[model samples]
Target: MSKRSSISRLPDEVRQHIEQRIAEGQMTLDELIHDLRERFPEHADDLPSRSAVHRYGQKLDRRLAAIRASTEAAKIIREHAGDREDARSEALTAMIQSELFESIMELQEASDEEMPAEKRVGLLSKAAKNIATLTRSSVTLKKYQEEAAAKARAELLAEQEERLEELRGEDGMSEQLEDRIRNVLLGKA
Candidate 1:
């Protein structure tokens, strides 16, 4: 297997600093490298070359951009669509499904020589578990929604029955009339 990039092997705090500098949109790769070397003098020789830093910075920029776009899209959805019928959750589920598909495709195309057999199997197993979990959660959500609708319908029927009793007592309404109303409301008429 190819060795990991030098930047990838940097300490967590240094990586976070690099990511922060990239996000701030204020520093060129050379400047960032210079700053890193100045701050971590002991690691000056270990720091990656400019091209490596640029590649890492570009990847981080893409990730940050994706995050910004996602946040903006969610804000617009909330403002206009308001998550009615749990649309937000549905959107997130679809996003996850798309990501899972992409991950599976990547795994399928990955070079066997570059990755170990056991690691590939582990990744595939994890993907399968994710799919199963997502399916189970979706089914549970649908069942919960159905139960909620049934409960609401039952409450409406009870309210209607109470109103019918009032009419029967005060107006002496006929039993046939009440039966007709019930049938109509239940869509049996």
Candidate 2:
């Protein structure tokens, strides 16, 4: 009944192109279909209806929203990437701590003086395994935290160093004079 319904169907390529233009926010669905009818009158009937185009547009809208959310998530990831990894490692280590390891540590404390040599040796070996697990996990967590902290500090220092260089360049300080001022500045101000 509509002007578009009078002619033969349009090709998938043109329909897709129409959708692309709509997704680009370059035109409304009605305008797109109307223009398609005008541009390719022979395929008017095949061209998508306004409602169909609108449904496709809704899909595009949802896709755009998802893209926006992921972009925001990526920014958050970049802002806390190092700290997040360290926190994860620490959390996992804390969660994995076993009763066995705790008992081992307690045994070592208890055996400091009076435990017999034979019993002490057996208990110590078992305790050593448990303690090693704890120690290794603790050391790993510590190293991760340390490495993350060092990386953050290095990045901060690099940025400060870049800013300092920019300042020096802006003021046209000579190479030797820059070093002299840098020595007096004491690391990063």
Candidate 3:
């Protein structure tokens, strides 16, 4: 296994401090490292160099940016989508499928000589199986959404029919008119 980074070996409080400082975007790598050493003298040796700090900072920055982006996306989805769990789930699954597709394409482009044939084949096989499973999941979600919607529509129609029963012959409404309304609502007219 690869050795862990010196920064990774830092104490929890120090690591949290570094992560917070990095996230705040106000500290340079040199400034952050200097401050870390000064603040945590006993564990200064565990602190990373500027380059290592830079690498870790970049990784953390990307993660924080992704989180902010996702937060913004969720806010937008909530504002417009309005409790649309199925739409969100479908969109998330699509995004995952797209990422998997790109990764598989990259793997396909890599030569077998770069990796052992069996290992590469195994990876591809796993990818194919995942794609199949994801597709099946998408199909199942669609069917579930459809079934739930149909059930809801049936319930609403039943309630409407009950109201129609109550309204029969009231306000000069006839059975013929109610039948017409029911047929129109049912798309059988």
How do these models rank on TM-score, best leading? 1, 3, 2
Report the lDDT tens digits of candidate 2 across residue range 35-70: 888877887656667777777678668878866875
- Cα distance off (Å), candidate 3, residue 117: 3.8
Instruction: Report clash pairs, candidate 2.
Output: 8-46, 9-46, 10-46
Q: For each candidate in the order shown, give its overall lDDT on alpha carbons.
A: 0.81, 0.66, 0.81
| Stretches of candidate 2 exceeding 4 Å from the true structure | 1-12, 82-189
Error of 2 at 96 (Å): 29
Residue 33 C-alpha lDDT in model 2: 79
List the candidate 1 regions with Cα displacement exceeding 4 Å.
Answer: 1-4, 141-189
lDDT of 2: 0.66
In what order do the candidates fall by lDDT, top score first?
1, 3, 2
lDDT string, candidate 3, 114-139, tens digits: 66678878988998899999999999
Tell me the deviation in Å of residue 69 in model 1. Answer: 1.6
- Score candidate 3 by TM-score against the native: 0.62
